[model samples]
Target: MNEELLKMLNAINSKKEEAKKLVMEDKIEEAKTAKDELIKLQNKFDIAKDLFDQQEKSKDEEIKNKVKKLTVEDEEKKGHNAFVNVFTAGVLKKAVNEEDVKIYNQMTEADPTEGVSDGGLTVPQDIRTQVKELRRSLDALEPFINVEPVTTLSGSRVIEVNADQVPFDNVDEAAQFPDVDTPKFKNISYKVVKKGGILKVTRELLQDSAENILSYLTNWIGKKARVTRNFLILNELDSSFGGDKTKTLNNFDSFKDIFNVVLDPSIAISSSVLTNQDGFNWLDKQKDSDGKYILQPNPVNATQKLLFGRYPVAVVSNKVLKSAVEGAPEAPTGYKYPFYMGDLKEAITIFDRESLSIEFSNEAGDLWGKDLTGAKVRERLDIKTIDTEAVVKGEVSVTV
Candidate 1:
């Protein structure tokens, strides 16, 4: 509502400035002409006396005058900064990784042992200081050092589905392998059409130099890189979290933006494991008579270290669905929903066979972006992937 008014006010302000400049430079004739234009504009604006008067009042006066803020938003806006442009029209596209958790704590029939201490990796402060000093001393030769910045991800259980009891030599190769009945793989495959996952990155656990170093690191890379990607993080094989100097070793306990998740595999799995162990440090060891390791596992609750950039979401909006049902006499006689808005980016769109629809890459480059507002926008990535199977037959159905 204030858009039109703002345009007028900005023009008035520009003209006033121009008039002041012209008069100061001794351009009397030009200044007079500009002043005349300003006067005319002011006169035109004066017709809306109620709006102009309302805008002239200070915020405090306006607030005291009105008890209900929302009901009198026009008055409230007048009291607030008029130059603000809230970018509410921006679109959100997020990706996430879905993981199937295997029960690692399941009893595999092992013997109970009276153990006071399990050899855990605990680097002493003095040793850490010594190593840090050594690094500082060798700063000149640091670049030449062939340090291994390797990551070993763990606990990614085989991707499985309950639909059919299909045997697999390897779940990773299932897509390439033939179905039991199809003898030879007849190019029959299921592309990841919809995926819903989330990584909630948080900054809830940091202290001292740890905090200082973390702060420095975040300032260097966090907002700058602003890069996102798909990866299987293989850094869980060692106690030292992967040697990515750009990232953290212990955890993501320094960021406050929760709900934004890091869709990395290693970080997700390792974080999940550590989360399960947090409550166990409080438990005292015990003995069991049945000769079984009756480890009283603590109540495990993970805060889902929010780095999962976004709660990956996928939604079959009207636009998307219309595109999905294109070309057929029936509008999507059937639709398979494997994801919600939270399921986006689980499986990247290897191919978008749907025409006039857009798909975005990590760099924010969009394909088929110009026609995004049309009815061809699909809600399902699967429907967007196959050209032969899915077709758009009808023209866009939009109502004004």
Candidate 2:
């Protein structure tokens, strides 16, 4: 099936090139014929790919059944033991004991393609799911932004409306319709980039119970993934609107102006405030004329803080959203804390290409000699800002 899909894809590419050549040669009819064939081939490829995915899912179910049988046979052991056994065997290049051998044999019998040579053993589905959940839970910014799951490596999305443009006009009945501003559509393209790191494990840690090992690995990977994604997202927001859209707010009244005067009401309605701990500290110190703190607890979610009792404030740690250090001696506190207010879901989009993939190795470098193994984990995704006008960036400075 994979071979057939590749062949079809190649044919489509060839047909596309042929059509381009025909168009260049002024043969419109020939180009049209080639394009029709190309479309047909694309449809066939889609069908085949869907079928292939179904078959792969079916195989995964079968593998799960085999794992279930193994668990039943060893009622005292945890379900994660099977994964531990596989990991041990892959790293050691051999089974450690009779039970390890039995478990490894069952896994290979269930899925022959999971050998160490085949791009390392794909982490078990259950563990992968847990890791994914942990990552999402730990990431502070992901829940509020637009997240899109995509299967392809690269693609483009059409933005239907220009955020800054007013494309509508009012007209009287029976009057000649005046030409309103035409809606300008924009295309945002994304390509997934691989982000990964290696986790070095000591021999003693690997010797722990299966559940403990799994817990430790998942926690580490989850936090690392969260930090990596947060860094990328914050950087994207800064680069997109940090230039002309940035504002400087000193007092409580100026901060209020972000929503009241800086941003359009349409955008302000759906906007939230994002700031570092330093900026939040500044806001926390502000009081109204009645001596009430401007930042109050959110009415709906008491645990969350709200700015002006309207917009929720998301406070990122100063470590994650670092302040810029000033060069001059007279600069207040020598740092500028970043503050962002906007509809983040409209401002940024995250294209998730695939889930977390982990591979273990004992032979990497001098691991065998030092009795240390490395677990390499990788994630693929892309981040893009679709609407710059939806967000306002601010930098706040205060004297010590």
Number of backbone collisions per candidate, in order? 42, 0
Query: Mind giving the per-residue lDDT tens digits that candidate 1 earns over 1-400?
Result: 3666678778899999999999999999999999999999887776665576676666657777776666576533321211011000111121111110011001111122111012111112232233334332311111111122112211112223321334444446446754453222223233323222211212221122333433332332222111110111011111122123122212223111111243233222322111112112211122346653333333342432122332211112232122223244454353211111111122212222211111222222242343221111111122111111111111112111
Model 1 alpha-carbon miss at residue 231, Å: 13
Tens-digit lDDT track of model 2 for 1-400: 5888999989999999999999999999999999999999999899999999999999999999999998876752544686676665655566445554455445434354444443355565566667767877843677778899999999999987753566557889998989877677899999999999988878788688887888898888878877888888888988997977678877667767888887878889999998888888888888889999988998789889898788999887888787777766555456777888889998999999756666777788998799888888888899999887788888887655
Q: What TM-score quantifies how close candidate 1 is to the native fold?
A: 0.14
Instruction: Give candidate 1's error at residue 372 in angstroms.
Output: 44
Off by over 4 Å in 2: 1-79, 95-111, 163-182, 328-332, 363-366
State how far residue 356 of model 2 sits from its true place (Å): 2.2
Which candidate has the top score in TM-score? 2
How many backbone overlaps does candidate 1 show? 42
Q: What shift in Å separates residue 270 of candidate 2 from its native position after superposition?
A: 1.3
